[model samples]
Target: MKKLDYQYALKPDWQSDARLEKQTTDNQSNIVNLTLSDNTGFAELNPEQYTWLLSFTYQSTHKKKSGSVCVILENNEQNTVNHRQYFEAGETGTRYLNLSGLLADYQTLSQWQLVYDHCLLMPDATLLGFKKPDIHHGPILIIAPHADDAELAAYGVYSDFSDQVWITTINAGQNVQSLDRQYITGLDDNLKDAVSRKAKIRAWNSMTTPLLAGVKFERLSSLGYFNLTKNTFYNASEKQQNDSVCPELTPAISRALNTMTLPNDESNISSGKRLVDDLASLLDQIKPTSVFVTDPEIDPHPKHIMSAHALALAIQQSGHIPDRVFMYVNHLRKIKKFPYGPEHARTALPPWYESTSKFGHYSCYSHQLTLKTQKEKVVSFDSMHDLRSKPRIQKMLKAWWHKKVLKSGYQFYGYHHYFQTHIKANEVFTFVDGKTFSDSLLQKE
Candidate 1:
């Protein structure tokens, strides 16, 4: 068989891991059996020395229970690290899930073994890539709702093809919640967004940009009712009412114009016009061969939805004709029990329970990545904290890191679970033929 080009293939450790062991279903019981050399239950293991596929068969009893099979490591300090693989209810037979590949760094490679709890429970699990990924030939636009969206959702693809990518941060990332205290204090309404802008810029420069290096980043950030609000676009009915305004720009547009630069100036322009014009111009100039946007249908965040809508409109108006347009899932929000893990390196992406792709001309593909690519993805997060220059940003990341790596407990598990589980797969997109994307994306339920 002709092999695929994967960076991890060249790793000495991966070479040792080339052979895999497969297990058949246990005829004796309805229960799923964990196959391991440690029938004694504790075989000495090294992440580098030991790499094997976790095999499982889905019984009707399982009925589509998809989450993750975690690989947990405990050091002498008793700190824990997690790795997960998600499975859907219907998957069956001997499947290859490599848990040892979870150890992505040298610091994590030393003197460690799987946690008794994760191994003892032995559970079950779950591709996207490109066709002609000479992504550098034309352009690949990464449209992000905020500064960090690209890093969080599409970092692997961005990191691999940095020079070919053009990133556009669509909205001002200033968390309006942070400005609440200032607002009640009678601070000038004008300075609220200014403060938020400064705060976000400080973090972006110190944390986000450096963490995701070698990419061209541009902020076509919008102002006005678009400040930290969801549902920024007017649906068909609302469009008929005001023509230009999205009646529900947010919780309260009357709050104050806190924007720094373009808020007041752009106020005269409706969000729809600004959204169309700004992105249209960007598409015209970049003419990306591949464009990646947030999947409007799945990401429940309002801005995420609106940003997707904006990208659709821009593509429609620009007349640039991109070869491929992709969408991905949100890591933080677990939709209808969707497993949170790394992007899958397979072809043909899966459809969400209610993906809106049917409404447009779109085909999807899931890209499976090498274990090495997944490791680099995790290291990228740490690099931000270690190299960050801003005290405030560094402090924030430090707090988050402490929770993810230090505490084994947090809601829906914790960031530790997310990052560890995340390395296994990724969601990716590709475009379909002959469909006119229109204001349909701007419509409501």
Candidate 2:
């Protein structure tokens, strides 16, 4: 996990002179900056400490030019392990490299690098209309379907404007149907009992969620909670006394997988209406300048779509119109080629949404981060492991806490992928053209 640092890459004096020359030319308009990151950590590895390469994606920007890259690995230690390779890139696209073998060859290597001279692009001139950085104003509000989504999608925005933000978690944060407790083996004897009990614990962990909101402006009251998932509502309504609910095991979203109808449409819609009224009232109270929600129209996840439906209806029903609304993506579209980051935002729309929608198209903007904000983002991401308020939650149910989130939890599918997105300098959002969300669209079809 240990790898070389671009800021302090080890090089011979001649190479240092070359690096200075490269830097001097990079000051020109048409240059592709070559750098390295994702040091995959050094153990006192007897010089093999930081010897590893991750097969991951990285991007470098250029003045709309074509270029090739060359990398060199050298160990300053007594046992020299040196190697070199070449790569080609078009314009400012992403390239994925697997240097595990290269690192393995330099077992006792001290440092490595992307060879400056070979990192060249040719037959390229200039690109017109590069966008300026995205500027977001406060007080911003983020609405997330599950516990870690807000952080995954836009931690840069949250930390940079933490003092001027609020968060609302629309789900109870329990992926209940995914209730296999095998990972807790030896940690708990009564896995079934622990599973049932863990739902409430997830809700409790959720209460302190907004603590991750921002350093300065986000307050406890700035956050709001609503657990509207189909499996469970923090508070349930039993209208028609005889209304039958789905068996507790069924995921609520599964009721209508191909469409967005709530289960037993009449019955659930009644429940949805109650939710609509409550959310409308809350929106009226908050009167936010902007409302943030997940993409419902095309996001394949039903709970997310349902949340969006409910939100649009609430705005329609409440008669409270915010100046703007922002839509963030999760789960549906094929993720852009670049995964980890020097850049955080994506500009593409979901193919399905794009092909079918009358709205046509919209722009993408990135609320790029500062160095301080980037550090705060990494710290905020790492804090997910700290288990704050551990005394009470763990004291009452240590086994569930250990297996579900902390010790053995990375096995959960989305765990690693979610945090990896933060290794960048920006976060992106699709700006839904406001005119598309006109009054008519807010009303029921």
Candidate 3:
């Protein structure tokens, strides 16, 4: 691949001309105050090997300030840089040099320097070599709306990349009562109770069987409560009653209904902050190169909206956003309300459903079957119900099935069935990491 090199001057501006103060200083480090300019120069080295270098300058007030200057980088895509330090500032001077790395591993030399106190300096002093940007290859973390949302939305995609698919549910092993409780108690009391008493062993067995068979199953919580249905009100009185009783829930609910709502708003601000903190911690641990989240605009469900906000906040807080953040469609069954109608609807269909003519039936042997067998094995070992009693076994079976259906992969069956039986759409948002690519380059040649 041919390397591309470009540079622009960071014009002296009002912000860069602001007064500076020395907060602290040491033999090795110095903290100085200086405003940054908006006219920062950006360079794109290559399309495939996307690399960028941003340069700007700030004025210092401290005369003996001779330590390294640190710079932090951030972008809309959630990419960020930890404090990058450069030792280019001269001692006993008001002028401080600002130099930092944006994409450090790329195969091109892109530099920015501080030119006077207000102006930004280019790489006229020293030449840096071009190096290839690091390629990310890791597992994809899919945040499905419900239990089975992953299999319905990206079963084929997961199949295509089975080795790299790590399906996880924001909520898992949920039930109608537990859903009711979240609307009421906002706690995972049922899950804690079940686990404590070991009451829902059959339920857990059935729900987790399919996932363990092929994909890694990670459950955020077994409460399985969704934030969607709780937001909808049948009438004015109901809405008013909810507002009076649970005013705290109104904001998250409102954000779900209103797509234009930003994550920083009052309603989602606290939750957003918590999510950012949590995500920053997760990013430091997982360090995934790419992430998949539901699009809050398209996904009207409150849980989906919250999850999207959380993902965005997490990436921003991490200080190093992944290479890509893909937005997968969550609540496709609600697509009838979309303005584009038929044209937009087609984008939401799964690959299998998109080409029904190619496959005979949607059913395939999976981990779910294994779970059913496990349930029987457990019942036999515990003798929880008499094997000879038909009614008793039938009741246990029903209970087990219900619990199994609550698992992440099984919950999507309801929506998948709706699409298969009714509307046909499978649109999903795929945010590519690195520089944006043209349509022609993305398309198969």
RMSD to native for every prediction? 12.1, 15.5, 25.3
lDDT string for model 3 (163-202, tens) is 5555434332223343233323333455444222222332
lDDT of 3 at 150: 52
What TM-score does candidate 1 get on C-alpha atoms?
A: 0.53
Kindly list the per-residue Cα lDDT of model 2 for residues 1-445, writing each as its tens digit.
1121111111111110011113234445322323322122232222212212222122333332222233343442211111222222322322222232233432322244443222333222211111222234535656666555666566766666667666555543333333343224344355444443443444333334446553332232211123344322223533211112122421222122112222233333334455556456556655656566776555657677666666666677666676666676666555432332222221222223122332344333445456565555555554543222223443445445545655522121113344433444445454443335434244334
What alpha-carbon RMSD in Å does predicted model 3 have with respect to the real structure? 25.3
Candidate 3 residue 279 Cα shift, in angstroms, is: 3.6
Best by lDDT: 1
Misplaced by over 4 Å in model 3 are 1-136, 172-213, 217-277, 332-416, 419-428, 432-445
lDDT of 1 at 104: 48
Query: TM-scores for all candidates?
Result: 0.53, 0.51, 0.34
Between 2 and 3, whose TM-score is larger?
2
**What's the count of clashing pairs in each model shown?**
28, 8, 21
Top-scoring candidate (TM-score): 1
